[model samples]
Target chain A: MKADNAAIVRFENLTLGYNHHPAVHHLHGEVAPGTLLAIVGPNGAGKSTLLKGIAGELRPFQGTIHLHGVRKENIAYLTQQSTLDNTFPIVVQDFVAMGLWRHFGAFRRFDATAERRIAESLAAVGLTGLENRPIGQLSGGQLQRARFAHVMLQDSPLVLLDEPYSAIDANTVHDLAGLVRRWNTEGRTVISVLHDLEHVRSEYPETLLLAREVIARGPTEAVLTAENLKRARQLAEEQGELVGAPVCAADEDAEQAIHAHLGHKHG
Target chain B: MSLVDTLASVPVLSPFIEFAFMRRALAGCLALSLGATPIGVFLMLRRMSLAGDAISHAILPGAAIGYLLAGLSLPAMTIGGLVAGVAVALLAGGVARNSVIKEDASLATFYLISLSAGVLIISMRGSSVDLLHILFGSVLALDDTALLLLAAFASLSIVAIAAGLRLIVLECCDPAYLARISHLGAVAHYGFMALVVLNLIGGFHALGTLMAVGIMILPSAAARFWVQTIAPLILVAIALAFAGSVVGLLLSYYVDLPAGPAIVLTLGGLYLLSMIVGPLGPLVSRRRPRWHFTR
Candidate 1:
C-alpha cells in the first residue's frame, strides 16, 4: 500500500504462475529508479516470469505489480532471444524500427527524423551497413547486436531484458553489456535475467537471487554469497515438479514467514 | 487475318472473351486471389498454413447447413460458412489458451469433426451431385450473386488488411513485443481471424471448401521460396494466385477438367517448381556441405 516516488517497480505479495501454479510466489519487493539490477537464479526459478509480470505480459496470480509513476508505455522489454523466430521475413532496419511503435503508433510514416534515429541506433550497435539485410541472414553475434539496436530505439526509462546473452559470442556479449551499462549511466532502470555470476558481479550493482522465491535481494556482493546460492539451488530442488496453484497450507506458511522476514528487514 | 485478329483469335483469350461463364469464373477467381492470397502469406509466415486448411474444412458443415436451409442461396451459404469458420477459429484459440493442447492440434481436432459432420449432413438430404458441387465447387457456374459476394469480401479484406498492416505484422512476427506496447496484439489476432473467415467464405464460393485453402496457401508457400520480406511476399503470392486462376481456367476450358482442381493443381505445380529453382530453394541453395571420399 505504500507507494514510494523513488521506486520504478513495486511487487506486493506478488505470485505469478500459469494455470494457478506459481512460478514466482509471494514476492514482495520494490525496484528503485536508475538501479541496474541483475535477477539470477537456477532454471525454472521464475526469472523470466518476473520480467513478464513487470512488462504486463503476465498478470500476477495473487497480488499487484505496480509500475510506480511510469505508464506501461514507458517500459521496454526485450524477451529472451530464443523466443524470436529468426526465419521471419523482416529486414534489420524494419525490425529495429518496430521499437518506435509507441512514438508513432500503427499508421504514422517513419519520416526523416525517425530514419536518422534508426541509423544512429544501428551505428551505435556497429550494424550500420547491414540495415537492409534480412535478420535471418545475420550471425548469432550480429543478431544480438541488432537486437541491442532495437533496444536503443525503444529508449524507455524502465528496461527489462531476459536472457539477452544466451547463445551469443563473448565479443557480442561484451559489446551489448556495454550498452546496458550506458543505459544505466543515462539513469534508466534496467533489470536483466543473467546466468553469468561473474558478469553480474562486475557490471550490475544490485542483484536479486530467486529460486521460485526471493532468496536474497540486495547489493551484488552480499546477495550472491555462496550460502545464498546454495540455498537457492536447494530450494529449487525441493520445489521440484510441483509448480501450481497455492492450494497447499505448507506453501502459505512459508509465504507468511517470508513476508514477515521481508517486513522486518525493511522496517 | 491481321496480326490483331490472329492474336485475338487465340484460344486462350478467346474462351474468356467468348463465354460468359468463363468471364464470371475469371472475375470470381481474381477477387479471391487478391483477397485471400495475402492472408495466406501471413498464415504461412506465422507457421499456420495448416490452420488455413483446417479452417477451410471447418467451413464445409456451415455451408451444408446453409444449403439445407436455403437450397443454394448465396447469402445463406456465405453467412453459414463465415459463422462456421469464425467459430472454429475462436474455439481453437480458446482451447489453446486454456488447455495443454496447442493451437494446431486443437484446430486439427475441430476441423476433422466439422468435415465429418458436413459429409454426414450432405449425405442425409442432398444428392451425390449436390455433394460433389459443394466439395469441388461450381466456378464455371458462378452467377451474379456469387460474384457480387466475392467482390464485396475482397474489398473489405483489402481495406482491413491495409489499415492494420503494422499491427498484423507485429502480431505475427513478435507478439510479445506487441503485447508489451498495447492490447492490439489481441485485437490484431482476432481481427486477422475475422478476415481469414471472410476470405475463406469468398474462396469457398469459388473453389469449394475442400480446395479453397489451396488457392490461399499454395501461392503463399511458393512465394516464400522467392521473397525474403513480407511486402514482396504478399505481392508475389497475389500474382501467383491470379496466374494460377487464369491458367487453370484455360486448361479446364481446353481439356474438360474440373476448374477448382485445375487451379489448385496449377498452384501446386508452381510451388514444386519454386522449390527446385527459386533462390534459397532446396535445389538452388545447398544447405548441406558436399561429402567426398579422399585417399
Candidate 2:
C-alpha cells in the first residue's frame, strides 16, 4: 500500500455490499489534503454507506480504502445520527476523555498531560466549562458539539462526518460549518455527507455527487450543474434508490419540466 | 435521637450488631453495593435493564453446580456463578451483535435456559428446599473469611472500573466513535461485562444470587432520577445503597425478617420515594426541566 501523496483518502474501484449484493458499485474518489469535500445525493444513494465503508464500520466488498498512504485507522469518523444513549449518566468531560483512551496503556491512568489535552479539545469545540456536566442533560445542539469535541480530541489528520447537521438548528449548522472550516484551515482533510445543497454550494469547494456510483466529483461550481443533477436523479431512479424518487418527483413537480423527456425515458 | 442513643436504646441489638457475623454481613453488603453500582450505571445507560435481570436469573445454574462441587464453599460457588454470569452475558451480547434479534429477547432466552438448567442441576444433586438460599440469599450467615474475600474483590472491581472510566462510558454511550478509533470498544465492552459478572459472583453470599443481583442494580436505577452526570449518579447510588444496608440490617434485627429480603425491600422503598421526589420519576421533575450544563 504505497502512500498516496498528501491525499487524506483514496478510494479506488470501491464496491460495498451486504452478502455479495452490491450497494455501491465501482466507486472511486480521492480527497486531497486540506480539502473539505461535501458528499451529496438523494437519500439511499449510498452517501452514508460510502462514509461507513471508509470509516471501517462496514467492510468493502471490493477495492481499497487508503488513508494518508496507510490503512484507514488513522482517520476519525462521526456518524449521521449521534447514536449515543442519552440516558447514560456521564459528564461531558468524561465523554471527551474517551478520545484519549487509545493512547493509554492497558493499566495506565490518565496523566496530567492527557487531562490538559482533553481540556484543550473541549475548548476547541466551545464546550470548555461544560465538561463537568452530565451528557444526558445536553440539548440537541449541545449533544452535537459534544460529538464534535470527541472527534477533535482524537486529533487525527482526516475527519469523516456522515450528515452532522440533520435535525440541528440553523445556528448549530453555522457553527458546525465554522468548525469544519477551522479544521480544514489547520490542514486537516474533511469528507462530510451533507443533504443541504446550499451549505454545499457556499462552504465546500469540492463535491462528490453519489448515486451508488460517482455521479460527479470536482469543484462544486463546475460539477453540480443542472445537467449533472438531472443525470444524478435519473441514475438514482434507475437504481430504484428510495431517496432518489422524491428528488425526481420534486424535479418533475417543481421545475418547469426542463428534463421531462429524459425523466420519462428513465422512468 | 443520635445514632449512638438509638444503638443504646436496644441493649439486645449490641451483641448482634457488634458480633463478627453481623459485621461481616454489613461489610459484605457495603462492598457488593459499591462493586455493582458501576454495572447498574452502565446497564441503565445502555438500555439493558432487562439484561441485568436476565443475568441475575441465569447464574443460578452456575451457583448450583458450584454448590455441588465444593459443597457450598463461598469461593467455589462464586467462581461457578461468575463463569455462568459471564457466559450468559457474552452469549446475549453475541446474539445481539450477530443476529437481528433485539437485545431483550436474547436476554430472556438466556435467562430462561440457564435458570431451568440450574434447577435441573439442583434436583439431580437431590438438593430440595435448600435452593431457597440461592434465590433469597445467605447474607446473614456470611462468615469472616467470605466477608474479607468479598471486600477484596469489591475493592478490585472499583479500582479497575475507575481506571477504565473513559473507555467504559464511551462504550456505553458513543460506541461509534470508539469503534472508529480502534479496538477500544471491543475491549471496554467485554472487560466491563466481565466485571459485572464478577460483581454478581462476589455478591452471591451477601444477598443470595437473586437479591444480590437486585441490590447491585436497583439502587443505581433509583439514583438516576436525582442526577444528570455520571459521577454524581454513581455517588448517589453508593449513598443509597449504604443507607439501604443500614436500614435493612436494623429492620431485620428488630422485625425478625430475613436480612436479604429486608435489604431489598429497603432499596425498593428508596426507589419508590425517589420516583416520587426525584427528577424524571413519575411525581417529580414533571413540572420543570432541570437545566444541566453540557460540554
Candidate 3:
C-alpha cells in the first residue's frame, strides 16, 4: 500500500504485538480524511489491536503510525462495551460527562456550557431522561447508546469504534450508524470494526479486510470479495492454533502461516 | 424515672461519656470509619475486595519488623507497614502486568508469604499477650499519640478522596476510556492504592490487621444492597460503619467482649441484615420474573 499525502492516517510498515509475537505485521496503508472505513475480518485478525494502536493504548512493535493534521489526544476511541464495568455505581450522567475530560480536565468544575453539551449528547443518543439512572440498571442496548452518547460528547475529529454493533439491537445499530454517517458528513474521520458485512457494504464506502495481515483495502465492493473472505477465514483458522497456545513452536507456525498467506496473495 | 432521664441514663451512652479510654476508642473507630470505609467501597466496586484482605495481611510482616526494630513505636511500625503494604501492591501489579499470573493470584501468593513471615517474626521474640495485641488490637487502650495518628489519617483520606473523586470514578467505571483520554487512569489507580495503604495502617491501629479489612469491606458490601449511585453508596457505607463502631463499643462495655472483634461482628450483622431487607436484596427485589400465557 502506498502513502497518500492527502491521507489522515498513514500506517508505514506497522507491526503491533504482545510478548514479541505480532498481531498486525508489516501493514502499510493510508486512510483519507473524513472517510467512513469498516475494518472487516475474522476473529484474531488484529482488528481491535489496530484500533488500540491508533488509540495509543498499545504502542507499535515496529515502524510508525503517522496521524496527519490531528494530535493523538484529539482521537476519540469507543472501546468494546464488555471492557466497561456495568456494575459500577455510576449514574449515566456522570459516566457520559467523562467525555468532557479533555476540555475540563480531572479537577475542573462542569459549568453551564458543559452541562448543556452533556444534555445535548444524551438527547442525541435518545437518552434524554435517563441521566440519573445508574448504569448498572441499563439494558445492554441502552448501555451501548449511553457509550455512543459519551463518544458524541468527545467531539473529536477522529472517531474509532471497535465492534459497536455487536450484541446491540437493530434499532440501536441503525441509530448509531446514522450518527456515524453524521460524524463523517461533519468532516470527522470514522473507522469502525464491524462484523455485519451487509451493513458495511450498504453503509461504508471504504473497507480494510484483514487476517493477521491486510488481505485487501480500497472500495468496500472491491475489497470484500468472496475469494478474499475465504482466504481470510483460512488464514484465521491456521492462526487459531497460536492463540493462547504455549509460546514455543506455535509462534513460528503463525509467522509461517502469515508469510504463506501474504505470499499467496502477492504471487 | 421520666422517659428523657431514662434515655439519657442508658448504659450505651454512659461508658462513652464517663471513661476516657472509651472516649478515645470511640474517636479512633469513628476516624477509621471516615477514612477506611470509603476505600473499601472502591475495593468492592473494583472486585478487589479480596485484594484488600490480602493487602491487610501483607502489612503484618512490615509492622512486625517495625516492632522488632523500634519496640512498639507507632511511627516506626506505621512507616514499616506502609512500605511493606505498598511494596506488595506494586509487586503484585508488576507481576500481573509482566507475566501470565493474574492480579488475584499474585496478590494471594504475596499476602500468604507476608502473613507467614510476620507470624514467624512475632512468635520469635514477642510474648503471647503481645501477639494478641498485634492480632486483635488495643482500641480501648488508645493513647494521645494513637488518637492523633488516626485523626491525621482521617483528614488526609478525606482530602485525597475529595481531590481525586472524578478521576477515581472514571477509572473504576471505565478504565479503558480514561486511559485513551488522559494519563489519569494510572494516576487514579496508584493514588487510590496509596489511600488504601494509608487507611490500612489506620485500621490496623484501631481493629488489628485481621479485622481491619472487615471494617473496610463489610459496610461497602452492605451499602451495595441499599444504594444505586456512588455518592449515596459511599455515604451509607460510612454511616453503617460509624453506627457499627458505636454499637460495638457499647456492646463491648456492657457484655465484656473484645472490642475489635465486636465491631467486626456488628458490621457483619449489618451486612447480613442488608442482604435480606435492603433495596436490591433478594427478599426486597425478586430477581426472577413471573410468567403469564395469553391465548
Candidate 4:
C-alpha cells in the first residue's frame, strides 16, 4: 500500500472486473507525469478494463486508483472506435466540438473563440475540409482522425485510449501516433492499450505488460521482452478471463428491432 | 378572393377551421411533434428505440391505477404514469445491467406484465368505453385539461432538452467517452428517457397509447433517411409529423377513420416514401452520391 505523492496515476492492489470476476487483478503501479505508456498483452489481458479503471468508468472492486492533482473532468478517454455510433447524425465539426466538454460544458456560448479551437483541432488532424461531412460518411481512418481531433479539444493533462489504432491503416496509425507524441511533449500523460509491439517499442518509452495482473512494468525494452509476452499469454490462458462487458451500446437486438418496428419489408 | 383567403378555402384547411376539436387536436399534435421528434432521434441513435416503446407500454399500469382510484382524473393519471414509467425503466435497466438478460428482453418482460395488469385493472372496474378511450384515445374530443397538459409538457420538454442537449448527444454518440469526461451523461440519459415516457403519456391522451409511440418514432425514422445532421434531422422529423397530423386529421374527418392510427399511418407512409426517394435513401444515395471526396 505505497502511495506515491509525486505520481500522476497510482494503482494499489486494484481489482477491476464485471460481476466480481476481476479482469484486472491486484494491479499495483505508479505512472509518473507525462509518461507515454503502452499497455500490451494477450487478447483478454485486462488491458481495456485497466484503462477503464483509470478513466473512472469502473470503480475498483478491491483497491484504489489515485490520481494526484487531476480533476476527473480533465481526463479524455476514448474506447474502441466500434463503441462509437458513427451513424449518428452529427457532423465532424460538432462531433469534435463535444471534446470541449472540459471547456464550454453542456450549454455555453460556442462563440468565435470556441469555433476557432474546433477549426484548429480539425486542422491538427488534417481533416480541414471534411468538417461538415457527417461522421458516418467518414472512412475508418478519417473517423479515427476525427476522434483524435476531439481529444485535442479536451486539452487534458491525462489521456487514456483503448485500442485506438486496432483497425487503422499503417499510415494513419503513424499519423495518430505522432499526435500522441505531440501530447506527450505538451506534458500530457497518455496511457494507451495497444497490441502492436513494434509500434509500442518505437513510439512508447514506457510499457506495462499485463495478463489479468501485472506481468512486467518498466521501460519498453525491459517490459516487452519475448519472455514476458509469452508469460502474459500463458497467464491469460490459465486464468481464463471472464467475458468483457458489452461496450457502450448493449445492442443485441437493434437491427431486428428497428426493422420489425418500422415494418421494413427489406430487412 | 386574396391569395391568403383563397388558400384558407382549400378543402383540407376547412375542417380544422370549421371545428374547434380539430384545431385543438392539431395544436396538441404539433406541440408533441416539436418535443418528441428530437427525443426519437436520440433514442434511435442510442439503439434504444424499442426501449422507448417499452417505457410507453410500461406507463399503462400506473395510469390504470390512477384511473381506478380517481376515475379519469388528469393529475392523478399523469403522476401515476410518470411513477410507473420511471420505475419500470429503472428496474428493467438495472436487471439488464446486473443479470444475464439483455435490455430488450428485460424491458419486453416488464412491459408485457405492466400492460396486461393495466388492461385487467381497467376491465375490472371501468366500462368497455373507458378501456377503448384509454387504448385508442379521443383526439376529436380533447378537453381543456388534456390540451393544457400537452402544451406544458411540450414547453418543459423543449427547455429541459436544450439544457442537457450536449450531454444527451455525446452520450448517444459515445457513452464510454462521455462517462470518462463527465457523469452528466448518467443524469441526462435517465432524464431524456423520462422525458420520452412523459411525452408518450402526454401523447396517449391525444393519440392513444397505441398510436402515441408512433408519432414519437415514425417521423424520426423517416427523417433518418433524408438528413445526416442532428439539427436538420429534428427539423425534418417535426415537419413530417406536423404534415401527417394535418393530413391524417382531414382524412379522418372526411373518410371517418380512427384519428390516432390514421395519423400514425400517414407518418408511416411518409417514412416509406423517404426510404424510397430521400436524397440519402437507398434509391438516391446509391446512384447519385450526396458528397464526393477524393484521396
* Clashing residue pairs, backbone N/CA/C < 3 A, model 3: none
List-wise, what DockQ does each model earn? 0.64, 0.45, 0.67, 0.57
Q: Give a tens-digit lDDT track for model 2, residues B90-190.
A: 88989988999988788889988988888788777745656777777788888877778788878888998888876777777777766766676788888
- Residues A150-253, candidate 2: write the lDDT tens digits: 78877677788988988888887888789899898887778999988888999999999887778889999987899888988987777674432121233322
In candidate 2, stretches whose alpha carbon ends up further than 4 angstroms from where it belongs are A1-6, A69-71, A100-129, A242-267, B1-7, B10-18, B126-129, B289-295
Which candidate do you rate higher for DockQ, 1 or 3?
A: 3
lDDT of 3 by residue, B28-140 (tens): 99899899999999989888898888888989999999988887788888988999999987888899899999988998899889989988888888887877787778899
Q: In candidate 2, which residue pairs get closer than 3 Å at backbone N, Cα or C atoms, i.e. clash?
A: A3-A69, A89-B230, B137-B208
Candidate 3 overall lDDT versus native: 0.87
Q: Please, what are the lDDT tens digits per residue for candidate 1 over residues A13-110?
A: 78888875788888899999888999999999999999989988787767789887678866888888545678999999999999888887888988
The model with the greatest DockQ is 3
Which of candidates 1 and 3 is the stronger one according to lDDT? 1
Error of 2 at B223 (Å): 1.0
Better of 1 and 4 by lDDT: 1
Q: Residue B172 deviation, candidate 3, in Å? A: 1.4
Give the poorly placed runs of model 1, Cα more than 4 Å off: A1-5, A18-21, A24-26, A61-63, A212-215, A225-267, B1-4, B100-102, B287-295
Q: How high is the lDDT of residue B42 in model 4?
A: 81
**Candidate 1 docking DockQ:** 0.64
Over B55-131, each residue of candidate 1 has an lDDT whose tens digit, in order, gives: 89999999999988988778888888888999998888799889999887898899899999998988888999888
TM score of chain A per candidate: 0.88, 0.84, 0.87, 0.87
C-alpha lDDT of residue B237 in model 4: 89
TM-score of 1: 0.89
